[model samples]
Target: MVSRGYKKRGVGVMGLRHVKNPILLARAMLEHGEDDLEANPRGVNSGDLDVPSAQGHTQLYGKAAEQLAQQYELELVDPSYFFTQRRWDEHVRALEREKKGQGQATWSATEYLPQGTCGAVALDQDGVICAATSTGGLTNKLTGRIGDTPAIGSGFWAEEWAEDGDPTGSSTWDR
Candidate 1:
């Protein structure tokens, strides 16, 4: 699912499971610069190109997720978005507060999942699956930083329902 927020940003989610290593998918993004602007810009680069500096902080988590998948041989999935750091920070803080038993709060969808956002979610035939996602994260991210990508569960997850005849289990990361 790709979510975009008005005057804010957008996000995407990709999910997978029951495979060899789910984390590997996340890790691969880092090794190959899945979201590096220098390596994967949206437009042609000219000598006088005035494009803003692109951010790849989310790739950190994508790599981490890939590593976990490789080590555990589990399926992996990820959701990504192009959102502002402030909005990402808000989601992070909200998740943290929720962990502390705080009541649920409504977030501004327009500021989180805006239009023009795109992503993918993949599932295996037997219900096992893997997913990957990418985005520019907060149009103007800081010079040196990271986001929820490295935070497991928050960025990706492997879920199994009773219909699958397996005990409900999941792997997640939080930061």
Candidate 2:
């Protein structure tokens, strides 16, 4: 979303959507919230969110994201959009290791994997601050394993504060 010349929202991922570029998804959400704020000024409501299935160990968000994309008139791609042979093989190997009581091996591999959690922070010319992150939890994680990547504040955050009525100025410090 950074290269798109827009920076106004924060987002994080946790094995959901499986999109190759999660920034696009985060951008969409930011736009969605912007629209809501424009209309209500108070921000979006819970119902406005594209919540995923409340019950599901596998946590397939592709369908959910697709639905949201359709609603927002955004482009949608096939499952292969985020598919890769290396990732698939790694997932399979991790699963095998997990079944063989080698969960640590799977964790270690994920720790070093190049495709793990990602995050970004940006400040636009207009002073807009945006932060975002995305990740497909450790490869072959347990069925119910849910990481903090998808949770706001836990994975990423963006804040704006002014000191002495001047945002660009330094504030008085207290011990």
Candidate 3:
């Protein structure tokens, strides 16, 4: 609930992608007290952050977050941080390049596949099945290109459907 959660009392999100990175979480910890908001994950530029072994990202963030949280300090992560003027300018430049038929795909020697979603499927006691997924974005994709993770049935889907393909169970929207 990063949209407005930091303002509330005793409210925090876990595994929720950070707006930029650990700085925000550190700020929250300082304001709300570390005990109120226990654990959270923070990172930046998730769009192109797909390495073969993701632990590298994890380890890097852990060190940064611990330092920031301990001192309630914040630091600029350069172009990676959200809303830096330099980064904004670079985004505009990239858009212009793409419009002119010039775009770079892979960032480095090792190009990872576009696999971003973390998913879970559940079957309740009543036999109702549900699926949920979350993603940061595709790796090495165009800057603003939204990945398939949120594409409903394509990315993540569940539940029974009738012969005609409509949902089998009651839905409030039909009213």
Among all candidates shown, the one with the greatest TM-score: 2
Q: Clash number for every model?
A: 46, 0, 0
What shift in Å separates residue 87 of candidate 2 from its native position after superposition? 1.6
lDDT of each: 0.39, 0.53, 0.40
lDDT, candidate 1, equals: 0.39
- Residues 1-175 of candidate 3: C-alpha lDDT, one tens digit per residue: 1111222222122222233444255235434452443333444655432222211121123334444334344443443443445445544555565566655432322323334346666666765555545555443355545455544446555645335433855555554
Q: How would the candidate models be sorted by TM-score, starting from the highest? A: 2, 3, 1
In candidate 2, stretches whose alpha carbon ends up further than 4 angstroms from where it belongs are: 1-20, 34-62, 102-112, 165-175
Worst 10 residues of 2 by lDDT: 51-60
Instruction: Please give the distance, in angstroms, between residue 125's alpha carbon in candidate 1 and its true position after superposition.
Output: 2.0
Tens-digit lDDT string for candidate 1 (10-84): 222233323233234433333333243543243464543332222333322233334334443445333333235
1-175 per-residue lDDT for model 2 (tens digits): 2212243234322344535455665566555543433222222775554542222121224445544445455565666777788888877766777678754554553534676667777787887677666665666556757676665555556777655554555545531
User: Candidate 1 at 119: error in angstroms?
Assistant: 3.9
Task: Kindly report the root-mean-square deviation of model 2 from the true structure over all alpha carbons.
Answer: 8.3
- Root-mean-square deviation of Cα positions for candidate 3 versus the true structure, in angstroms: 14.6
Overall local distance difference test of candidate 3 = 0.40
